[model samples]
Target: MTTSNWLLPEHLSDILPAEARRIEELRRAMLDLYRNCGFELVAPPLVEYTDSLFVGNSQDLKLQTNKLVDQLSGRTMGVRADMTSQVARIDAHLLNREGVARLCYCGSVLHARPSGLLADRELLQIGAEIYGYSGYEADLQIIQLALDSLALAGVQNTSLDLNHPGVSRALIEAAGLQEQAGEVLSLLKEKDVPGLRQLFEATTGVPDDIAAALIRLPSLYGDGNVLTEAASALPDLPGIRAALQALRTLVDALDATSVGIDLADVKGYDYHSGVSFAIFGRGWPDAIVRGGRYDNAGSSFGRARAATGFSLDLRKVSAGLAPAEPSRAVRAPWNSDPALGEKVRQLRQDGNVVVQFFPGTTQSIDEFVFDRELVSDNGQWVLKSTN
Candidate 1:
C-alpha cells in the first residue's frame, strides 16, 4: 500500500453529523427568514469561468479560487468563492429589467485561501442580493435580514463593527500615504499595535505627522464620538472625513446603541465603495457575516448599480453555538397505505418520530432481516432490542 499521512492542515476540516445537522438547521432558518422578507432564492453553480468569476468581485479573488479546466470545453474555470458576482452577472444579463430584483442564495462554496486568511476554504454562504436598487431603503432591508439571522443563529456577545470603505479609501489617499497605509493597516488588523507604531517610525521620508496619524488610526476604534476625534486629527484628510460622515449617517440611521464604530477596522476588498463591515461575536473573530456596497462591480459587465449584501457563514455560526443533539437523517414515507400515512402524519405533528414501511417493500421497514424460518406460525414482526 502507498504511504500517506492522515493529518489535515488547520485549513481543511470535516463537519461530523452532529455539527453538520446543526448547520443545516441554521441554513434552513436563514432561508426562511429571507423568504419572509420577499426575497426569491436562487442557487448558482459552484464552478464558473474564471474570467466571469473574477470580473464581478475583482482580481483579488484570483489566487484564492481553486482553478480548473472544464472537461468538455477545456476552458479554465474556478470553484466559486462567493455568490455575489454570479448573482450580479445574472441580474445584468437575465433580468434585463428596470426595477430592483431581490434575489437570495444558499450553497456550499470552495476557496483556496486557508482558514486563517478566512474561516475555511470550504464554506457555506447564504445571503440575498438586490439588483437595480440604489436607494438607502434597499440597504435597510438587507441590514434587517442580517440582524434577524444573527438572532436565529443564537449568536451572543455580538458587536457590529461598521466602516465606510469609501471614507477609508478617501482618507488614506488624502493623507498621501495610500501605499504605505495598506501595510500599516495590515499590522493593525492583527491588533499588532506595537508593530504598527514601529513601522510608522521606521518608514522615513514620510512626514512624521502622517506617520503619527496612521499609527493613531488603530486606537480610533469605538463609538459615535470617535468620528469627532478622527475629524480633529485628520482635518486635512477630507476623503477620510467624508467617509466618516457617511458612516455617521448610517450609525445615526440605526439607533446609536445598536452599532459600534472601528475607524481602523478595514475589510479585505477595495471594491467596497461605500459602507463595509463584518459581524464578530465571542469565539469568532473572523466575520460570521460580511458585506459592503459594490456600486461599480456590475459596470464590468454592462450596467452600473449600487449593491450590498451580507452572508451568514453557517459553519462558524454553528461552531460558536452549543452542539445540538444528533437526529435521524432519513425518515420513512408515512406508510404504504393512505390511512396509515394519515396516522403517521398525526404522530409527527405531535412531535413523535415514527417510520412506516410499505407492505410489499421487503418486509415493511427492515424491522428485522432474517431467514424465513424466523417467522412463527402466527405471523408477526418482532426483534430483540439491543438494550
Candidate 2:
C-alpha cells in the first residue's frame, strides 16, 4: 500500500481529540449509570482462546472473529467481535455466584468485517447483562436501561424494535420446513417477501396455513397494534402465543419509549431464544442499541444461566448525539515563584484544566480558548478573563 493509504485501514480510522473526549465523557456517564442501577462493572480481555470466545450459540461471533496464533502457546486466539459471550463465561466460570448477578462492561471489539455499509470495523461496546433470570422482568429491566442510556447520550425520538424468535421458529417447525429452515430464516430476516414467496412455492410438503403465516412474518412490523394483529394472524401455537403475550406486556410497561413489533426481526434469532429488541433513533439509519435474551449462551462454559442484556456501540451512539461542552482551562505562565506554582496547583485541584505557557517556546493561546490567564498583580497572582 502507498504511504497515503497506510494512514488507516478500510473502515477504521483514528478518533481525533475532540471526538475522543466526547466518547470518553459518554463512556464515563454510561458506566456511572450502570453502577447506579446496581450493576457491578467487569473488564474482560480484548482477546481469548477461540474456543472460549466462541462458546455457546455464538456462530455469528465465530464468523466475525479475527483469529491469530499465540506465539508462546501456539494455540489459536480470537479477537472478540462481541463481549456478551465473554461476560457469560465470567458469570458461569469466574464469578460462579449463586443468585442473580448484574454485570456491565465497556470496551472495544474488533470485527473481521463491517456490520453495515457505513459501520465501523472497530467499535467500543458498552452493555449490561443479568444472569439467573429468565422471565420478562429481566428483559424489561435491560430494555429500560438501554433507553435510559440513550437518553443520557442525548438521543431523542427513539423507537424500540421488539421481536421474538420463538414466534417464527414455532411456525416454521409446524410447517415441517425445518430442513430448509436456515434458508427460509435468512430470507425472513432480510424481509425478502417476494423471495420468500418464491422459495415457499418451490419447496414441497409445507402446509398451506403454515406457508401463509411464513409469508406474513415479513409484514408483521409496526406499532403495538402489530402484536394484536400477529396474535390473530399467526397460528395459536404455545410459543407464538407466549411470545406475543410477552411483547404485549413489554409494550405496556414501556411508557416513555415507543415500541414496534417485527415478528421476523431475527437479527440474533439463532442466539437469542426469547424476547429480542433493537433501538432506533431519529436520523440514524441503523439500530443504536441491540439486545435480547439468550438463555443457553453459557451452557458450553459449564452452566446454563438465563441471560438478557443490551449493548450499543459508544462511537455510533455518540455520533448522533451532541458533543459536551469543552472544559475551560486557566493559562499559567512558566515561573519560578512558589506562590504562582501553588496557585496553578490549587486551580487544577479545583477541577480546572490548567495549561502552562513555557518561557522560551512560541505557544498560541488561540489554539484553544483559555477562559482565564494568570497574571501577577502587585506580586500576587490573579486570574484575568480573556473576554
Candidate 3:
C-alpha cells in the first residue's frame, strides 16, 4: 500500500485552527508583556551560516541542529535549533550598543529530533534576553519575567529550580578531572553517589577534598536550607562560595515558598556560565521555562558581553492549558443590499467577528460560535441574538 499523502513525518504535525489560534494569542500576549517591560522585539532569520548559528552554543545544540548545503554559495547552512545564539550575535554585531540591550523574540525552531519521546520536532520558542549586564539583578529580572509569562498564561503553582554550573566545574577543575569532565557531569546530573564514588576510587591522583565535595553536591538539594548546608559541607573554594552567594541572593529576594535549590543540576552546565533556572508547574514532569547567564556565548561572535535570558516553548505551554473558548461571532448574509453590507462592516470594525455566509452554501468552523446573526427586518438590518 502506498503512504497517505496527508501523513506527516514522525514527530512532525500541523496545528489545526483552534490550536493555532490559541498559540497565536499566547505569542501576542507574551510579546506584549515583554514590550511593556522595555524589551524591544527582534526576529532572527530561520536559517543562517552554521559558523554563526553554532557559535557559543553547546555540543547538544549542535547535534540538535539540522544542517544543509546552500546551492547559491556552496556554503553550509543550518536551520536554527535555538535562537538564543542568534540573538546574542545580534547584540554583539548588529545592535552593538555600548551600555545595555533588552531583546525579545518569538519564532519556530526546528530540532533534528524530538527533545522527548512525546515532544514535537518543531517548537514555537519565545523568550527575552538582556545583554551587557553582569550583576545578578539582570538574572532576577529575567526570572521574574519568566514567572509573569506563566502567570499570564494562567499557570499556577510554579516552582523555580535554581542551579549554578560553576559549583561543580570548580570542584572538577580543582581535582584535575578535565579529561573526565563529561563523565563527571553525567554522574552529577544523575545524582549517582555510588557511581561517583566508584569512578573516583578507580581514578588516581584525585584530591580527596574535591572528590568529597563532588559527591556531596548531589544531595545538596531542597529548600533554602540547602544553601546553608552546602556552605559547611563543601570546600571553601572561591567559585563554590560565589555560586552559593548567588543562590542566596535569589532565594532572599524571591518568594521562599516557590523556590527550590538543586546544586547538582548539570542540564545547562556546559552552556550556562552562571546561575541557571528551570520553572516547573504542578503536575508537569519537565520544566516550563529554562534560562540562565551565558556570558561567554558571544565570544565567538567577536564581542563578549554579559548575557542572561529565559525561553519557553509556546506550543508546549499552550498544550498544558485548558481548551480555548470559541470566539463569539455574528453570522451575516452575503447580499447586494448596501445597508446590510454597511452594518456588517461596522460590526466587524467594532471588534465583532462577522462571518458572511455564501448565498447558497453553509460552512462550519470550530473556531467561532455563531451566537448572533444579522437579519433584515422591514428593510432594515439588525442583529438578532441566537443564544
Task: Find the candidate with the highest lDDT and give its number.
Answer: 3
Off by over 4 Å in 2: 1-6, 323-325, 364-367
In the range 288-387, model 2's lDDT, one tens digit per residue, is: 9999999968888999899999999999987776654566788888989999999999988998888988887867443356889999999999999988
- Which segments of model 1 are wrong by more than 4 Å? 1-10, 56-60, 175-182, 191-208, 327-342, 345-352, 356-387
Per-residue CA lDDT of candidate 3, range 239-316, in tens?
999999999998999988889999998998779989999999975669999999999688887899999999999998
Cα lDDT over the full model 2: 0.89
Candidate 3 deviant stretches above 4 angstroms: none
- TM-scores, one per candidate: 0.81, 0.95, 0.97
- 10 residues in a row with least lDDT, candidate 1: 367-376
Clashes of each: 2, 0, 0
Clashing pairs in 2: none
Ranking of all candidate structures by their lDDT, best first: 3, 2, 1
Residues 88-118 of candidate 1: C-alpha lDDT, one tens digit per residue: 8777766766877788998888878765754
Instruction: Output the lDDT of residue 274, model 3.
Output: 93
Which scores better on TM-score, 2 or 3?
A: 3
